[model samples]
Target: MQRKVLVIEDSAVSMNLVTRLVQQAKLMPICAATLTEAKHLFSQSNPEEFLCAVVDYHLPDAPHGEAIDYAIASFVPTIVITGRLDEETRTHVLSKEVVDYIPKENTQVYDYLSRLLARMEKNKHIGVLVVDHMRSSRTSMASLLRRHNFETFEASSAQEGLDILHQRDNVQLIVTDFKVPDMNGTQFVAELRKSWPKEQLAIIGVSSGNSALLSARFIKSGANDFLQKPYCHEEFLVRIMQNVEYIENVETIRRAANSDYLTGLPNRRHFFYSVNHVARTSPALQSVALIDLDHFKRVNDQFGHDAGDKVLKEVAKLIANHFSDHNVSRFGGEEFCLYFANVAAEEVDKSLESFRRAVRERPIRHQQQDIPISASIGVTHQGRKNLDAMLAKADELLYRAKSSGRNQLQSDLLA
Candidate 1:
């Protein structure tokens, strides 16, 4: 179900903007011009359906952030937007358990709000670890993280933090205090760095101690960022968001490098890397198949390159769904590859034949036209040999399959 965002704004222009932003984040926006209307709308629905509420600070019905309080009391995360840029107002808004507040002084703040909404939705899946010897400190930090929709894990010591990380693979960020029974913050960070690199995991060192050198020490020990003690809520959230985004941006780039631009399947280089890793296990039975789409060029010539691309994508989707348990890749234009491990030759042959029939039976629909497509596959069931050698045999067989006729399977076993 699409989650809802409760947008309580009195200004016509602002309400329109917030509603559009909520929709852009793939959320449904429930709008009300006043707090009373918001209450009536919210009462009619479940609070769990709301991702968060974007409330204007000075709603005519509740001018002093009463709506913010009401939303928080009702267990809905609230974000305050105000034209009041005074520090007093900022402090008052932050004092409440709201997610965060934005000053509606410029259009840029709305952009920030958009990003914040997106992060809140994404944070539901991202786990954050909080490590501190003091129970109060750990709870304080974890509570703040939870308010933003992050799955939070609490650890009282560095060792406990490490253990939690070992058990949970989804943890992406760690906030650690300098004082711990097992190790100092810098030592703990260094220990974590030995296993988790900066790109894969982010660690932020926070200290309330008066030592000025602590930040440098933590950074030198491989912490991604450092925060001083008694940090403001905004500063704390900003630091956490920056570190998390850094890790996420690196991951995005890594995935783009490994994926095919058109079909969104694993590319050839990634295929080789993955298959070689599996090959190192030396399975008793292994097979490699190279698949080439038959008459693929004719599709492009008859229709256009766009239709040809669509056909490739449709075939790629079928390959992914049919051979989900096997490693599959789209080797550049009109060709794909599959690696099967520990499967009998007969089973591999059966699977390939089934896949071939699936392709021949399904016509790709593009631009209101049905475009027929088929694949010629070459299989090599040479067990536990050089992957390149297997691929070479498969490619040779593939040539033969194309040579004899199209839409057929040729294998070295048959040869």
Candidate 2:
């Protein structure tokens, strides 16, 4: 249990005793008596050097909450320990949302701290799912995953994995055997790619027999990684964590490029890219719409920018609430867009009618006053060849909606 812990205690004598306790638990303890000392210590050490922190409230420099905030900001789980404080103060300090709180004067502080640190050590691990055709292989792989503190599950077949996904939700990863009954792992993953979130799952397809082109096929069918069976435990753990981290990194990158931080909606770039992809890939009918709030500038001028932001968010909620099935995006300030793939042109009218009714029925009240907001939509279906052409046509129809009437939908609406 060679874990690292930062112990912040004001009393040097108490610090010495706690240090010994941490050492006895087989942990590396870093001691700091004050907020300044803890800050300096953290700023100087490598991130990988420390696992978590045990902070003290009422440090000499700053009292309560500050240390907790700083430690949490540094991505360390913090436990606040204090003595010579009343119950109110202890409750107040604990209320600061630190991971845990304790009294140093209590007889059980050392035992409690030991248990907390051990729990943290065990929790910072990857989760794995082992899918194998044979029971012996499944158990073997699950044991290998568990040795590294991973919470692992097992499935005997690919179809069983589909059932397992329904039963288990926290599973962030899958390590499936290449060959299985009913559906092979590759085919099963291909089906999974349609519904499940590809970015959230770190899939490792395993193969024991004929490790030839199967690995490449797995990667092609949406598996993020591969592992040859009879793998060494260390190699397996490393590879599994690597893929987990890789998926998280890719998601971070995609979010940076595609998401709006303000309303937490897809940005214009993401909207455009998705529209194009669906247009090129799906031969099924689809519709694209450019939606704009009417008299949005007036709302901003009347309500101040903050209130205007609230209204935009409110409208976004309306769009999401009313058209939950459609892919929606915020196209900059007061402007938005939507894509309904695989819907007929005539059906688009009925859907948009329902969306319009929903928005009109709901009122956005701010400061006890109802602020009316309505959108003009320019919608068009792809009879056209490419996505760009559909967008151009939708924009034209959108212009017609805005020019003709503010609260209306137009087809071939663009000027």
Candidate 3:
């Protein structure tokens, strides 16, 4: 499910700022100006309504702990923001279920909220322990991760690294270099892998000079990957991301399993996912356009399936070109669908007309003849209806377009 964020602030400016920040964090946001309104919104929503919430300590309706308590009860990770976070209130605030207490106008508020969002994503705290016996190396690595917004811990030796790993379950990745005195890198990673096994923590080994044999040994010892030392800034960042991004990509592709293979366009599964995601995330009005190629069966009949595939590829490219800014997907077979964010149905008509003109001007070149094609697009705007219902309406209009005239665009907007 997509993570939703609730920003409960009475000040419109502060509310707007927090909303933008939450959106930038890639979470859905629902704004509530008062505690009563927030409660009203919360009661009618599902249990997964939100992942986290940003709530001001003082609200227009309820200034005390009621709103925050309500949020906590609803299982949303809460961040309490106020201008009155002195030592006394800070202690009391931390005692509550709130994630962090922040001073609203402070420039560091961004950092505070960003870190809170990261921690909430983990469903817990963020901690990275650097394992190097050398005082300078330990300090440098830990300081770097900390500067990049990670909470870091340092372990001075292999034994110390083991101790920190035992306690810090949230340690996502470790950057440890070879050449630690006493027990070297090989022994350290070997012991780490042995203990953790499948849920073993991520490891990135570091070595300087020609450590090809050393890298092989480390990989055998269960390190996920390694980077040679004396690496520049870009190399360091890229290596870090290479090791980290795989986890995210796996999760995204797992979610995107329904995507089609032929044209790399989203299939029915991705279409619904995007539709639901866009519905939850976009605040502006929107419309959907269902597109189908005119006389699609004749193309398939005259030119074998190979030629049909080429036409589909070309159509996919055209759809991508015209609907680049929208949520365009292949709804199986020859049908293409788009959810134009913040665009009205009337606007979709103009957009579809331009698309038709472009595709007709370009030829598919089947059988050495300039085989021209046109599309009939049907558009319908958002309504108090589900995606299924809206699709039915769009499908009806698409039939109208096909029957009335093969090359014309028809819309179900208003009358």
Candidate 4:
């Protein structure tokens, strides 16, 4: 189901703009022009159906933020927009635990809104670690991160932070203070680099000392960025978002390079690299399978390349589902490769037989036509041979399977 976002703005122009922004983020917008309508809509929604909400501080029915209060009471993550910039207004809106307050300056309002939405969407899954021996500092930073929807973990000292890293591998960002009980911020960053690189994890150092050397030291020690103590909330958020964005972009590009664009399976290049890595790391016997679709050329000849693509996708899905735990890849057109690491010898044949039966029994439907697909598979188990030799043996057996009959399994071990 598409996620929905509630927008409560009295001004027609602002409401229209907010709706467009929500649509651009690919979220369904439930727009309310007044406080009464907003409450009615909230009453109608399922608690889990709405992702978040945006509310204007002044509405037709409730001018003093009643709409924002209602949203907060309903447990919705709210973003408030207000024309007022007084301290009292800011304090009141923030006290309600609305995600953040956006000023109605009209110059950068929508830009900040879009960024917040994007951050909230990604933040729910990204884990952040705060390392500071001072309870006050750690609590303050963790509270801010939590308000932004980031999953937070706290560590009192550098050693504790390292232990937390081992326990929670998904930690993507670390905010550490220079005055930790154990190692200082710079030293902690250096130690962390031994396991996590800049692309895999981002570190930001915060220091109360105004010395220029502090920032320089942290940056030189592999920290992605640094923060001065007593920084404004906006500045801190921007720095965190920027570093996290960089990591996300690098990861996305890496995945694109390693994955097949059409079927989202590992591409041929990644397949070779992973197989060798697994062979070197795993001691248990590994099995390699080379599978080729039998007479796949006929699908394109009969139904065109588009239909052939559909069939290949369906076949890939079948293979992935049948061998969900193994490393499976698209080894170029009409061919795929599978690597089963640390598996028993007998389990290899059993798995392949099940996959073959699934392929033969199920036909892909393209344009209301059922197109049957079958594959020839060959398996080889690692003995004293290397990965390259095992793959060669598998390919050799695959050729024999095709030569004997189109849709069959052939392995030297089975003989």
Candidate 5:
């Protein structure tokens, strides 16, 4: 079901702007011009259907943030927007348990709100760990994190935090205090850096001491960021978001570097790295297969390169779906590779035959034309020796398959 965002505003200009932003975020906008109308609309709808409520701080019917109170009371997260940038208004908005407030002074704040909406949706899958010796501190931090839809974990000691991290693989951020029974904040961060690189896990050190060097020490020890105690709600949330985004941005770059630009499959370098990692375990049986599209250059010669690219993409999709359990990759051009561990020779041969038949039967549609395609596969199921030897052997068999017949599976297994 599509989640809805309840937008209550009196100004025509602001209402239109907020509505567009909500739609751009891929959320349904439920608009109300007045507090009474908002209440009527909300009473008829399910509260669980709403992702959040964006309310005007000064409404015609309910001035002085009464609409904000109503939205919070209705169990929906509230975000306030107003032209008033005064200290009093900011304090009043912050006093309420609202998610965050946006100043309507410029267009840039609306962009921030858009990012906040996206983060709220994504945070549901991200886990955050809060480590503090005091239960009250841990609970307070966890409560604020929960409001943003983050899955939160609480640990009272450094050792407990490490244990929780080992058990839960989804944790991406850690917020720890400087004082703990087992280790201080800098020491704890140093210990964590031994295994978790900054690109994979984000850590923020918090301290209330008067020392000016605490933040620097934490950073030197591999913490991504630092927060001083008595930090405001907005500042704290911004720091957390920045660190999480840093790790996410690194991951995006790494994936682009490792994936094929044409088909979005793993490139040859990544394929070699993955197979070698698995080879260390030395399974009882292993198989390698090299697949090549038969007469692929003919398609590009008859149809344009665009049509040929479409065909390759379609075949890549089929390979992904067919061999989801095995390690699969697209070695440049029309060739692909697959690695199977711990599978018998007979079963491997049967799987390859099935895949060959599938490729021959399915025709790719391109430019209103049906482009027929087929693949020749060569498979070797010898015991583990080395990846290079197996790949060379598979290549020799692949040459034989293409020589004898175009669309066929040739394997060393006798059947």
Candidate 6:
């Protein structure tokens, strides 16, 4: 389900800007220009659908922060925006347990609001580990993380933190105090690096001491960033967001590099990499199939390239679904490769036949035109040879399938 962010702004320009930003962040935005309109929108939608809200403190219908109060009462995390901020408004907004307040003095404030919305969307899926020897400090950090909608784990000592990391594989960010039992902050960070590298996970060290040397030591020990113990809420969140964003960016780049743009399947390089890893780890029998679309160029030449692309995407979807449990990749244009993790040689024929039947039955529909599609598949079960040798055998059979007749399945096991 898509999470919606409620935006209540009286200004048309700001409302449009904020809505665009929300959509750019890939979140659905429910916009209202007045407090009465907001109420109507809320009445029509489910409260649980909203992840958070960006509420302007002053609205034409409800002036003097009434919208903020109502949003808080509805139990939605809010980032309040106001044209001006004074002591009274600040105190009132904070007292209502709003996430943060931003003074809308310039264009940059809207950018800040956009960033806050982005963080709220991401925070729901990220897990942070808080490490501190003192119970008070640990609880404080955990509470803050929870308010930001992050999953949090607590550790009273450095060794316990490491143990938690070993147990919970999903921990992405770590916040540790400078003073910890069993191992100090610098040593703890150094030990964490032995297993989890900076790209995989991020660590932030916090120290109460005024010594600048502690910050340098933490960085030297592989911590991504450092924070002073007495830090403001905004500063803490900024550091955490920066590190988390970096880790996510690296993952996004890796996925883009390994994925096929047209079909959303793994590319040829990734397929080979996965095969090598499986060869090293698994001793069970596996099967590899090389698939080629029959008369694919004719589809492009007759129906045009766009129609051909639609056929390819539809065929890829069918193949992926038929072999949902296996590794599937687009080896190149109109050619796909599938790797079955574990299966007996006898069962390979039945599975490949099922896929062939499905492909034959389904037609690719594009621009009010239905195009028939078919494929020739060549499968080879593992033998006393390397992956490359097994793939060579499969390719050889694929050629036989094409030469004998199109839209058929040929297997080495049959030979």
- Identify the candidate with maximal TM-score: 1
Residue pairs in collision within model 5: none
User: Against the true structure, what is each candidate's TM-score?
Assistant: 0.97, 0.52, 0.45, 0.92, 0.94, 0.91
* Backbone clashes (count) for model 6: 0
Q: Which of the two candidates, 3 or 6, achieves a greater TM-score against the reference?
A: 6
Give the per-residue lDDT digits (tens) of candidate 6, residues 134-248.
9998887787777678889999988789889989877999999989988899999999999999999999999999997999999999999999978877678778878998999
**Residue-wise lDDT of candidate 5 within 200-258, one digit each (tens)?**
99999998898999999999999999999988899998888888888889999999988
Off by over 4 Å in 4: 64-66, 83-96, 104-111, 282-284
Candidate 6 differs from the real structure by a C-alpha RMSD in angstroms, to one decimal, of 2.5
lDDT of 3: 0.74
Best by lDDT: 1
- Scanning candidate 5 in windows of ten residues, the lowest lDDT window is 406-415
**Cα lDDT of model 1 by residue, 151-189, tens digit:** 999999888999999999999999999998899999999
CA-only RMSD, every prediction? 1.4, 13.8, 19.0, 2.3, 1.9, 2.5
Model 3 lDDT tens row, 96-149: 755556777676777657645654565224566677767887776664454334
* Candidate 5: segments with Cα more than 4 A from true spot: 301-306, 366-369, 383-385
> lDDT tens digits, residues 212-281, model 4?
8999999999999999989877678778888888999999999999999888889999988887887788
